[model samples]
Structures are given as C-alpha cells and as structure tokens.
Target: MTEGDGNGFDTMSRRPPSRSIIEAVAEAEGVPAHELRPPTYESLHTVIDPDALDALFEPHADGTVRPAGRVTFPYCGYTVTVDADGSVSLE
Candidate 1:
C-alpha cells in the first residue's frame, strides 16, 4: 500500500487510486484538474482506448467491473499505469 504524505501524494506508492483514472494521474502530477483532460478524452488516444478503459473499468450491464490485467503508457511527463486492481501509478 502506498502511503499518502500530508499532501495526499504517495510517490511510487500503490494507493487505492482515484475513482476517475484521470483524477489519479492528474493528482499525481500536481496539475490543476480543470486544465487536464480525463483519460477518456478522445484526443489522447492512449494504448488503452478511452472507451475500452471505460468499458473495462466502469460499471457494466452487471453493475460490476472486474480486473482485466494491466497496461502502462507515457503521458504528460509521467509514466501512467493502469493496473489490474484498478490502481493508477505515476513514476
């Protein structure tokens, strides 16, 4: 488990991560939430397609989402990783 410092940042730590994938990444970057685009933003076009990310992580017809392995990519000066347990890592 990653321990959040007083400011809610846990460098290279494995915290619960934010509900919104973009939130987690943005939080890690210390960037203003408003200026950043969510992971689902179409222009980004990450290794994990925005829609696929939503479909894999977001609620489905069963109202539940399950782990579907992991994927990592570089973005905005950080190495963003989406994990199987639904945690985002920035290192």
Candidate 2:
C-alpha cells in the first residue's frame, strides 16, 4: 500500500503479506495459532492524518499505533486502514 502527501510526495508505503506468510510469522512470533487470520484492506480517512501514515509502516515506530493493512497480533480479527491522505485507523 502507498499514500501520497498533498504535495505529491509518497509519505507512506507498505507491502502486503501472503496469507501463508502471515500465519507463519505469527506462529513464530508466538501469536496464538488459532487467533491468526488474513489481513483485510480498509480506508483510514475517517480516523487519522495522512502525513502520519508512513510512520505506521516503520518498524516499532510507535507501539501504540498500528499501520494500515496489517493484522493485529493475538488474533483480534482486525486490520489497519490507511487513507489516501495518510490517515490511519483500525477496521
């Protein structure tokens, strides 16, 4: 996923993960096997600022904020959403 700043700069970018890959990583990370699920795409415009979207993709950028298009750990059955303007939210 990618989002551009108002001035046309790509402020945020993320790579989608295959279902198998996500499951494997989650298992290796000690996330509950029964709790894992594929991530779903969602629009973030309703929740956050566009310029901050890029930060979500950055590893450990903020423990409190999750990146769009990413699945949460421990099988919460939720995915992050990133809007075109770079805002982020969970769906």
Candidate 3:
C-alpha cells in the first residue's frame, strides 16, 4: 500500500505488482513511467513476464490468500523484490 524512494522502497495497494514495479522504478529514476522505455531502460517484459508475475501473487481460486512469499529479480539497475503482501522493495 506504500512506495518509497532513495535507499528504501515499499508497497503498492490497488495496482498489480507489474504496474507497481514500473511506477516504483520510475519514481526512483525521477522519470515518468513512459520514459522507462528503450534507449534509457529495458522493457520490464525483457526481464520478467509481467502477467506471470502478477498471477504468482494473486489470491487463490478459492479466495484464500497464498502463504507468505517473495520474488526477486534484476531489472533496470536495482534488484526488485515483491512480497506476497504486495510490498515491493528496490535495492
């Protein structure tokens, strides 16, 4: 539900993790999300499948939340970590 800049980065509440990642990185880079494109940065898809990433943390078919978990990967310059609770950290 929150996002941070500088040395610490955090969560996104309503948006999907994929979109949150873009926003978080854009904020960190001091650019608009649209500016996070070719010639400056690689597309997020080139690094990770956005749709799959979203699905990984979605609530289960039965409406139960998944167990606590996190996914980490390298994108842009920072390592992105997305938690089951929807918190995203960039480091």
Candidate 4:
C-alpha cells in the first residue's frame, strides 16, 4: 500500500482488508507484521478474527460487491477502522 495523508493511516489498498490492517498496524509500531508477536505485543487473534474480518468486506458469494461501509474496533491500543473501499486507519 502507498503512504497515507501524513497521518497514522494508509491509502486505499487492493489487498484484503485483514492484511492491510496488520501491515498498517505494524508500520505504526515500527516493525514488520511477523514481529508483532508475543512478549512485547499481543497477537491479532487476541483482538479479532482475521478471517472473519476479511470476509466482512469481501465480495459476495455470487461475486457482487458488498455495500459501502466500514468496521471499527480496538486492537493493540489503536482504533482500527477498515473501510469497504479498502482503506484502513489506525487512530
């Protein structure tokens, strides 16, 4: 994904929202996603189900787009927001 608007967020992405969220959060933490592990940080699964998050914004079973919307939740002290347009923001 490209850089965001100078804030702690990311520009729109073509990747799955779940992947975007992990990458963005890791970027904010100044580490790679693989490094966002136990002892220092918490597991993403401790906060939310990654698979379910991906499904929420994925296209329908028939390949139709889901309605425009967003899902927000708390993870690792940041407010994670995933937009239907594939933008993810950490606040």
Q: What is the lDDT of residue 69 in candidate 4?
A: 88
Per-candidate Cα RMSD to the true structure, in Å, reads: 7.0, 15.0, 3.2, 3.3
- Over 4 Å off in model 2, which ranges? 1-43, 59-91
Quote each prediction's TM-score.
Answer: 0.53, 0.19, 0.87, 0.82
TM-score of model 3 relative to the true fold?
0.87
Better of 2 and 3 by lDDT: 3
Query: Across residues 7-78, which tens digit of lDDT does each residue of candidate 1 receive?
Result: 222233233333345566556656755656655342345444676664555545776656466666666555
Poorest lDDT segment (10 consecutive residues) of candidate 4: 1-10
- Model 2 lDDT tens row, 1-91: 2222322112233432222323433444457544543443222323334234444444563544343444232222334333433333323
10 residues in a row with least lDDT, candidate 1: 6-15
Query: Which pairs in model 2 have colliding backbones?
Result: 50-85, 50-86, 50-87
Candidates' lDDT values, in order? 0.52, 0.35, 0.87, 0.81
lDDT by residue for model 3 (1-91), tens = 2333545587667578999999988988889998999988999999999999999999999988778989999999888999988888898
As for model 2, its CA RMSD to the true structure in angstroms is 15.0
Best by lDDT: 3
Question: Ranking under TM-score, best-scoring first?
Answer: 3, 4, 1, 2
Scored against the true structure, residue 39 in model 1 reaches a CA lDDT of: 59
Clashing residue pairs, candidate 3? none
Arrange candidates, best lDDT first.
3, 4, 1, 2
Note the residue pairs that clash in candidate 4.
none
TM-score of candidate 4 against the unseen true structure: 0.82
Reference-based lDDT, residue 13, model 2: 30
